[model samples]
Target: MKLKNQHIEEFLQSGLLDRYVIGDTSDTENTMVEDMINQHSEVQLAYDKLQEELFLYANTNAITPPDYLKEQVLNKVTPRKELEPEYSKHENWLSIAAVIVALLALSGLGYLYQQNTGLKQEIVETTTQFENLERDYELNDTQKRILEMRLAFIEAGDTEKYLMRGYIEEEPLRVIAYYNQPAGKAQIEIAALPELEKGLDYQLWADVDGEMVSLAVLNDLKPKTISAEILKKASDLNITIEKAGGSKHASVENLVSSIPLNTIP
Candidate 1:
């Protein structure tokens, strides 16, 4: 029994267990290995261990073959020769079935990969739409705040509107002013004003006690604001064209327009 046990251990380590699990053993060798598995506990355990390892390897390394390769593999598969009566038909059937199931699983993996890729694209598109909606919401919120402020200014009791026109009729310059005397605040609208030549800008002045005080230097034609205490005592508003940036003192000869605030009442 000791010698027989040694033979069995030697057989287990001879790499026959690997060949048997992958269906590479001959009919005679197959019979011998099965008899050893039924008769010896060690042989059976080694065979079972080989089967488990093979299954784990197949699961870990399986891949989806391309369509043409799938057809080629199917065409290459042929039935094995009929073994003698002593060979187990049940074992052959299990091997063939395992092959079929593995092929089907590889095809299923291809489908699952496509589904995963499509889901990733949809996630990207949904993220872009959400970002665009957030930007639009922010723009609408800004416009809402601007409209509310404009409405408040219109409703104030001390607010006055003044229109100042250019002295030279051919130049055709104009501006509108919304002035609040109590708050000493004013908003100047220059939308109708002509575009300035290059290297020139419009400068505003408040005529206080015969002196022209600098209020603001205009860059673009956008609306301007004057929020100074000096506006409360100003008798008139003036605009003049100055060099780039502006001048320290108004060029009285270049006065474009002037409106008398004291005569407005």
Candidate 2:
């Protein structure tokens, strides 16, 4: 009932109307075409036009047998002494007209099927495109927020940048921290940290006057914010490999990276 112009055009061009008018369609096709004709005004109009054309063609090409041929048919029937009657020219013409109408109906039905199929495909494609666009928008929004936060950190005054690397040459770990001592604000970027084995976690600690205090545990790549209380009297920031869920006391023997904070201006 609700059809697009382009879809209607496609249906009309598919030549199904011609097939139906000529009685060359299946039962299923007949049902579909009938439904379309009932629901879609465009389809019904097209079907009407096609039938008119076929009728005109049939009339223009109709042939009338001569009188001699009719006599010969009647004579043959009489000689056989059979009571079977000979068919009249008008009767033959009627049969031809009926066949033409059946074909037209079949063709129309086929066209309807094609039109319905096309619409279904269009709907699926449209839905997929919408989903893709939505996903892209969300990703862009998240990136925009991150960029804004990074810019704010850079513009803030009295902020110190600290790059914390691995203690050993073979340990490929790099973490960046921006600390605003005056404002008691801090953010950490875990840029490059190798995946730890199962049942182990990377834990951060603040070394305050030779005593280590747990800061936060690293389990994901998301940005981490250090609490102001942990940075208040911290002299150094340290990372250590600890068991799953981290430890209350720092594992001194598992220290991986440490950066002295006393040099901050």
Candidate 3:
């Protein structure tokens, strides 16, 4: 007997692709048909691809048909005409139930399709963010290494240095220095300092001749170098402890350290 399209579809749904290809002969004629299919290269390729898709579908766990699919299939296959005429009254009711089941199956399939599409889009977006973060991390590491090299060069020479001293709430006396060079730019390195009290800050200054210029503010002086723009005209550098934001003019009594440009090599 020739195999019908419905038979092929049913076999596919039941996940018997391997059995169909191998031509198991215990049942007779199905074995012969399987042998023919195996011999055809075109058919074999199509079968292999179909098997891959079916395996993916099984693993995804995303496709779920409505519960009423079986009931709808049974209803359509039942021999209604062979039943007694008394059952005619019930035929309309069965037909309506079958239609409802089909509608529900269609809705379920549509919802599953939409969910699968959304998950794919989310995966793509997360991959893009990960790539961007990797690039930023590499750039930050390069900039940090360059800054360290520059600080080592400054610490090796007789850079002009100033000292600042201040007391906050009877805390231990704190001192910091301003190191300026004749090359127009300088860095401030804190050496031998007391811990700062809560809610107070230390600031650096560059006093050119008699005129003082503010340089930077230090909150937590951890052993790391910070970059500053080169000063255009400054002869002296000073440091002072100021109110949190610092003051417009250096309070004479607040002076912590003073270093002149002529003294620095």
Give the TM-score ranking, best first.
2, 1, 3
Regions of model 2 farther than 4 Å from truth: 1-107, 167-169, 182-184, 208-211, 219-221, 262-265
Question: By lDDT, who's the top model here?
Answer: 1
Please list the C-alpha lDDT of all candidates, in the order they appear: 0.76, 0.74, 0.56
Number of backbone collisions per candidate, in order? 0, 13, 7
lDDT of residue 160 for candidate 3: 45
* Candidates 1 and 3, the one with greater lDDT: 1
| TM per candidate | 0.55, 0.56, 0.48
Residues 1-265 of candidate 3 have per-residue lDDT tens digits of 2455555555555544544433222345444445545665544665778546644543453334556865665666465777776444334434443443454456567677778898989998999988888888888888789778656556646454444444445554444343444444455555545556566567766665566667677666553332334243556556676888777778768776655555423
- Could you tell me the lDDT of residue 225 within candidate 2? 86
RMSD list, candidates in order: 15.2, 17.0, 12.1
Best by TM-score: 2
Deviation in Å, model 3, residue 43 alpha carbon: 40
CA shift at 30, candidate 1, in angstroms? 20
The lDDT of model 3 is 0.56
Q: Under the 3 Å rule for N, CA and C atoms, how many clashes does model 2 have?
A: 13
